[model samples]
Target: MLTYQSSQDISITPTKGQDKPWLLLLLCCFWLIPGLVGHDPWKPDENVSMAIISYFMRHSDWTVASIAGVPQFSQAPLYFWVATLFVNALSWFGVAAHDAARLSTGFWMAVGLWGVGLAGRELFGRRNGRLSVVILLGCLGLPLWGHHISPAVVLLAGFAWYVYALALALKQPLRAGVLLACVFIVLLTGASWADALFAVLFAIFLFVFPQWRKFSYLITLITAILIAIPIAALWGYSLKANSSELFQTWWRYYAWGPFGGARSFAVGTSVGFLPTLLIWFAWPALPLAAWSVYLFRKELWQPHWQLLISALFFKSLFIMLATQQSEALVLPLLVPLVLLASGGVDELRRGAAAALNWFSLVTLGLAALVIWLIWIGLVTGMPLTLVDYFARFSPADVHWKGWGFVFALLVTLVWGRVLFRKQPLGRRALTNWTSGLTLVIGLLVGLFQTWIDVGKSYRPVAESLSAFMDGKHAQCIDVSTIAKDPTAALVYFTDLALDARPDNECLFVIRQTASKESATPEVLWSGHRLGDQKEIFSLYRR
Candidate 1:
């Protein structure tokens, strides 16, 4: 038989030793602040994000988003708009445009962590809220994707807002409705939600869980949709008002993409997405979250547990089964999983606790050591082979920065101090995992930032291409084979008006190929980065 949670049972009272705001703040700073500002826009995500941001900086057009000079219909303007603001705001303070745009991703990520933490508190307990954040910080995939420029992270913040708002809906129906309305607008406006329909349906679906079937909850659900309508319509109206072509393109392509995957799961899921890939992607949190669900098997119908389960089911139904697969799709899973994992920590058995503590120690400890050794190699010339190995990634003029040593040493000392402190194994395990992750990422970024930046940066290659084009006073150039990622990078780095579409009639052509040398006699320029063999771009006369 199911029972309702008593008012007292759900009340949140933070105990002094159980959680501390200062400690949580410190942990967040340690995890988020590193590896954010020290590098150039790396390819895959940052290049495109910065490219879009760069586009906004030069053009007064905010209604239509574009990559280079070509109109891009699918991208949501919200991210570029936000990123552009960050770049402009930070430029007066001496931050570079790319670094400031990247910081926009960090800003969204911080919001996500806050929402997730607060949601955990509302759904589970105050301590669990803090633990949820730690669990999320300890996730394997976060450090990379969370820091890079992508609206997916913004969507993540929206999901966190959704969960947080839903958790609030139980108590404050009207307020929760208004909050959910804002969340709906945010999701609907961004590229994250394919359509606003599912978000609406999902609010209604919550009533299926018996605990939330009351009239107030019904009012909450109704209020959300009613309020959300105007904003979504206004956005649509704005789009159509700006240009019918852009609105039609968005509705046709971007809005319906998620539902289109239902045709066949065989197109990708089982074969392409190995189960272990996501297992490690979610890491220790997944296992703990699963254990928590099973441990409370009898209480699975409880509102908090049921809410998380339903949310997970709702998300995974679309994301996990989608035809397209990227590691980022699994990020939203972390919010609920980490929240669940926090509950699991409360009931953590002695053996499991011991195992978790040792696991964090062994795995992250070893990783930290390896990073330190590599940092040492990069700084001092004792290990010739190792130094020589990393040296090839950057230009010959690039030298190790002294600031790397200072930053790395401070991180190491702090890590060493925390490593010996006594605490519950579960809390200790979470702490060690996040701390070690911070230390490792900190060392890499602080010690080898220039090397990593040089290897991945598009600046060198874009500049080379730009210089040749300038020397020739190039016009009507072609970009037939270039991928969008590099094209965006070229737009950002060179400010080139690469709008001309490709055809045989063009006077100049720019194509990217794996071949090191162009076979054409009309070649004007050919180049790649310092150690890259995969991409070699060439420009030539037709």
Candidate 2:
């Protein structure tokens, strides 16, 4: 029912207002698919974050550990405060803290999805908006990250939406300055200091852009910085107390294993490094994207160029500077990519739609093949080499059985209908089939592999500690070895106070490597004894 002008006249135009509701509904469904799979309680980060929440709920103190009845600062307490509210609210209604944390994560993540939809609608027309929402929700990264209640993901999503809204306001002068100020504040609150430099850069970009008609650029810049003052003060205070140790730990993380020297330059190490390069050339949509940018060169030179360039630069720079890297961080930059890609798709004239259709088919086919191979590995009981490699260092077990079948079946059903049916499907049908299938696959893969099965490695250790503390409700004293993961997991699962001193009474130790002689503590539980290393849960009671 929709129509457009000739390819030469094609632009990234907005859709009719009448189409807004339908697009919104599709976007909502895109978010719902991932939400329905339920949250997994097994991720170490999730476990620790939830544990911290539970501690705040049960105790009056907000410390990560209590020493001699004195509270000591640990990580930033903002995330804990948010999690605590959810836990307490859920407990009042009779839900467990863990479930509360899970539900809260889903709720915030859905809010984040709404933010993404709003960003899409503002940057592109309703049709491109629908595509942006679909791509974001369907992407493997978003759904996986959504389930973990880390502030990093929440900040990423929120800051991205704020940036999008700020860009939109930049195009209109009357309210642009105020909106820009407010958005800058929100970005600071959402991401803490992590987003500070990026936010400042964006604010500068907005004020200096030629589109602003009234307010002086200098005045706008001063107002933006003024708005961010409270956030900066709070960040400084948090740093003075809790940030020093975290930076040291982070530095160690960067210097060591996963983030270490040579491996840091590997294919997936930087956020957009690989994907951008790959998509620019090899992706079917590449030509369309190139043509779109080419056609819109004049528009690109205008005020909007600031947004596009700032987003691309900041996203790349931040990821490269990070001690940790993952593809999910690139989600913020997808808006620009979608705009460029859509513009490119628009330039193909009469053959544009046909070309897109073919590209879509090929992409779907490759995705299906990848899914099939994964399923085969799962169902056949063959070791997934990548998973095995991870399991070697962490306390996780990989199961490939049901996951493969589920993915394969889902892919088959959706593609089967799309390929075989001659009748045109409605928007709901397309959104549901494509986005829904993708969501299912993402959740299953994330929950089963990343959280559940991988959690198996830590389960015995966590459970052993749990069992040892059963009914006694004893406060934990000290735990030996701080490898970020095992120590973090112990604190999370057991909600126990940790001590670094070996001389402390009532010590609990998780020895990663075996020793020739046993210590004073009785070994409470042991797991799958391998050669030099076996995860042992021991308790030294005074």
Best by lDDT: 1
| Model 1 weakest lDDT span, ten residues long | 1-10
Global CA lDDT computed for model 2: 0.50
Superposed by TM-score, candidate 1 places the C-alpha of residue 146 at a distance from the truth, in angstroms, of: 1.4
Please give the distance, in angstroms, between residue 411's alpha carbon in candidate 1 and its true position after superposition: 1.3
Expressed as tens digits, the lDDT of each residue in 275-303 for candidate 2 is 55435322333344466667667666554
Each prediction's TM-score against the native?
Answer: 0.92, 0.68
Candidate 1 lDDT by residue in tens digits, 1-542: 11222233333334567446786787688777777787778879788777777777877867766774466654456778888999999999999998898788889889899899888878775566787888898888788887787777877787888888888887888888988888888777765345356667777898888778889988887888888778767766887898897777666656544433222213345444636566778877888889888888888877888888888887776675565666766677788888888777756777888888888878888988887777666656757898777667765333355776678778878888888866667677878888888888777766677777778888888888888778554465666568888887887788555753444355777778886884667778887876687889888776
- Local distance difference test, each candidate: 0.75, 0.50
For every candidate in turn, the CA RMSD to the true structure comes to: 3.4, 7.7
Q: Which 10-residue window in model 2 sums to the lowest lDDT?
A: 1-10
Residue pairs that clash (backbone atoms under 3 angstroms), model 1: none
